[model samples]
Target chain A: MTHLVVVGASLAGLRAVEAVRRDGFDGEVTLVGAEEHLPYDRPPLSKEYLAAEECPDPRYREEETFAGDLDVALLLGTPASALDTAGRTIAVGDRTLSWDGLVIATGAHARTLPGTEHLEGVHTVRTLDDAVALRAALRGGARRLTVVGAGFIGSEVGAVGRKLGLEVTILEALETPLARAVGERMGRALTHLHRRHGTEVRTGVAVEEVLSSDGRVTGVRLGDGTEVDTDVLVVGIGASPATDWLDGSGLTIDDGVVADETLAAADGVYVAGDVARWPNALFSDVAGGTMRLEHWTSAADQGGRAARHAVDPAAAKPYETVPYFWSDWYDGRVQFVGIAPEGADEQIEVVAGDDAQGGPFTAIYRAGDRIVGALAVDMPAEVMKYRRLIGGRKTWADALELAEQRRVQRAQKQAAKERGEGA
Target chain B: MRINVDWDRCTGMGMCESLAPDVFEVDDDGSLILHTEEISADQEGEVREAVAACPTEALSLDGPIDA
Candidate 1:
């Protein structure tokens, strides 16, 4: 391959370009991004960036240094319009670029409510621009913040709003926040974490209509006719994979651009990041093989893997990973690794600290005899151990053993600390 | 080669520890403990992986160590 084209100068796209150089591909590399800014970290947008008095610099590398070091041609502020698989060409803005190999990392766009698109004071935290605007609104003397969605983004925004001393309220359509993903019991336990910090979490409610005045949002009307008064509204309803440009491109499009076990959408065309949906053999038994992750870690891993495979197809290996993601809310940290297999009989057990007291805890999700997932809140080290176990497809009994070991070690450490303090 | 960590960007996520257990560790209170700053030839691959895997982009590799 003489020339390589990476679509979506995102986290995945940047990594793909880096991997190409690392794999000794001394060819022309072009990275196209919709935004003008260089590749920056997105996780901080909702956390520190929003909470801080000044926005923190989140760029992975400087634009000039990155381009000079990688010898890449960056097409920033230019979004790819379409793809031509047969001709191996992509439409970026007014120009058409041909490639010997392509990595599609278009990623996803934040989903907004239907009627609220034109309303002011409504924000979504998917991109840096979105976060910046939202942070400005928060710091611009906005009194009340109403978040429409109890998912990670919504919860984090609510937490940050509360930290800024705003009256924050989180609305969830489901009876329990994250009930489907983390089970009802654990979901309530997590939602309670924000409540401890003075964020009102209203469950089993949907936004019936967004009330506005003078082209600006004032509040939202609930499904039950109750209205909330607010100065700003945030719609964290989630996101859809940015695959609209790939229409009729001949690649199978399901929830995302469906790829094979090798992450190849077609010959010489590989897909990565949130836009690529492929069969992860790691969770084949649990999720029926098909999986797509929107996490930062997976994007980095799959970006490099897809690039390496595109450069050298013969040495390519199937991309199997123990999916991992972490979220920061209030004074606690939430992390989850591995797939919580969807089924009626799936079990959730708290093997670590007590969950009822609203403190630190680790819960393992089981599918029959095998441990499929683990969720850790404020237990970082123990979570990594469970991630290893989940990747190995270990059993419930094995997880229990590990939990017991952790308990014994914790007790020993506590006793030693007490002895030292006594002396 | 030497590994340089941007302490301001590091949140003690322990991703480096997970990728290269021998090179890094996260204490109980979520403080990062770097065992070694210099990277050996044998451990370069995993250390590079750890740097790339870091979500915050806080870890970076400098040029080769001086003689």
Candidate 2:
């Protein structure tokens, strides 16, 4: 039997084990995770889980599920300390496990602010335990909550704070929220959303220190020496790939484990999930020359794809998929399914409803005559049509017409279905 | 047919909407929203085109559409 060893018991690691079995691999698979708890979803950590709206359930397979369903061995709570790539062994604590193949799904770690140690109420959301702690803090009815970053996680948490009836103030070092990812316009849109929902979002401000007295966080001091009083401080600056274990593993570790389109690094080693920085055809203009995404669902998807290629090299292909991400904040659900690069020339082809009232709309990102990406809000049917147009690489003129045609066709289909003619 | 969305594989690159506008949509916050649970035979060509056009191979059609 092929002995496969996977490190980092995250969404990616769990899915990799499942993918191996799904791809007809009856091999001896061992999954090693750092966390003691079973693999659960992380996206909910910031939203529903943080708000106490839902408890953390086993989103992915547990030890019993893996052992019974896939017949895979799971090593929980033990992290892989070292990778002996040449020797084909992984050092976990004092014991070394041998493997015919290795999959490194060790996801990234949330970047935290210095001096945040032992400071009560200063938290970062990455793991289930972190979410549980943060949720407990919120349940205590903290007077004011200060989020240190304006990125996705911070913004989502800020939205949650407002929903929970807490005074939420966000401190962003950049001029706008999500400046690095979605440019000024979309960021401004989000800023508007936050402001409208009663969250205090301060841009161009930096967190100099997390203020505390008697090991309990009281507030944060800004770079300008202005102190904002608060009981909770959540930092969501960003993340760094969990590649410290591979210090001498001979694989290139830039921002993440450098892999090609096939997610292959060296001869017997492979990387996937947020820890692996693979070539991205969609966002090729980024400075890193590759994209390292650290989302929950995406990590699982990449893990499965990488596992398939690792099990059978003949089935390997370039990793290409339309990037899709969603966030539920306040009363509205925001979703993006395409590259909305910073400063890309965008054209508004279809606006389904009134923007002021929060309705469906589609904005097409265009570079010359070619449609590079699409942004949709509320208009699910129109967004669906635009998704197809983007994939087909259709021209602007053709895409517009198709969008109109699709609207009409969908209405007809819905009417037909309602009349019991299309069911 | 089960429509599979590899969320990690997706870069929020909206191609699915273009090919089968009747089936796939992007939500307000920029995630793929599926309009139909199952696709029809007539929509298969466009669906395939959308899937193939996915820069990340995030979209997949499993089994038969009628199934």
Candidate 3:
């Protein structure tokens, strides 16, 4: 049997094993992970799990499921110390494991500020344990929570903090919350959402140091020589791909493990998940060469795709899925599909509903006459419709008409359901 | 037969509900709420289109179907 050695037993790694099995590959599959725990979902760690919402049973999967259903050899708590690509073996601590095929789904690590590690109240949410620890700190009803970096994780945690009735203040070095991804317009809209939810969102501010006394967090010092007293400090600056183990692995490691369009790195080796920055058809031109995403769901999709390709390279196609992401702040659900270029040079056409209350609205991003991307706020149906329109390369007029038609159809269906046509 | 949406994967872009209204619906917070567990034979084509149209690949058919 061909031995498939998959490093990094994350969501992506676990899913890859399943995909390999589903692809009819009756082979020996070994899944290695640095963390001792079984593969669990990470997105909920910051949102639902922190809110103490049952933590979602079977966070990812039980070990028994992997053993019985997938027939995967789970090597928990063992880190891949190094990769000998030429030799086609991975050095996991004292043992050397050979492989007919290899998959690098190491994923990314939470970036933290220096000197904040020893601080008691300073926390970063990445793994299940991180969420458990943060939840424990939040349950204590900390007087205030200072969040560094107003990115998605920070903002989401801040939203949870406000919901938990904790005094929350977010320090963002950028002028807007998501200025890098969504331009100032959308970023400002998110900023408004944060402010509306009673979060003290401070933009263009930097945290100089996390002040701690007796190994406990006292407060944080701002770059402007001001001190903000807080019991807890959450750092959400960003994440770096965990590719240090591949230093001499001969695999290309840029921001992540660089793979071809098919997600293959070299012979008998593949990359997937957040750790693999592969060429994406959607953002290839805009992102220079390749795009690296840390999305939980995308990683799973990529894992499945990579596994299929690794099992049978002749049957694989290039990884070209539409880019999609979402943010849940307060009661508002902000979802975006496709890449809206910087200074997209487009007008916002077809505002579906009222925007005053932040209800359902679809902002069509156009470059001249072409619809490049769609931003939907509280309008999943329209967003779903537009996703097809965008993927099909539908004309702007057709997309607009489709959006309108779907809206009317939804209303009619709801009316019929209420009248007992369909329960 | 049915569309299973991994909510974690769902960006709430709402593509599935739009293409196949007979199948999918959105909650108050814009998260996808499946209306029916199994799609009628008539709505399969639309549901399949909706699944393919999903940008995030969040929507997938429950059972065997021609993709």
Using TM-score, give the best candidate's number: 1
| Per-residue alpha-carbon lDDT of candidate 3 for residues A149-256, written as tens digits (9 for 90 to 100) | 899999989989998999999999987667667666666666777777789989988888778889999988898999899988999999999999999888898999
| DockQ for the candidates, in order | 0.42, 0.20, 0.30
Sort candidate 3 into its docking category: acceptable
Docking quality (DockQ) of candidate 2:
0.20
Measured by DockQ, the strongest candidate is 1
Ranking by DockQ: 1, 3, 2
A346-398 per-residue lDDT for model 1 (tens digits): 48888888777555998998886888888888887667777778877899899
Model 3 spans with C-alpha error above 4 angstroms:
A283-288, A345-350, A353-360, A403-423, B1-67
Q: Cα deviation of A210 in candidate 2 (Å)?
A: 1.7
* Candidate 2 Cα outliers beyond 4 Å, as residue runs: A53-56, A282-288, A345-361, A380-384, A403-423, B1-67
What lDDT tens digits, residue by residue, belong to model 2 across residues A63-85?
Answer: 57887988888788878999887
Docking class of 1: acceptable
Winner on TM-score (2 vs 3): 3
Give the whole-model CA lDDT for all candidates, comma-separated: 0.87, 0.74, 0.78
State the lDDT at B55 in candidate 1.
Answer: 82
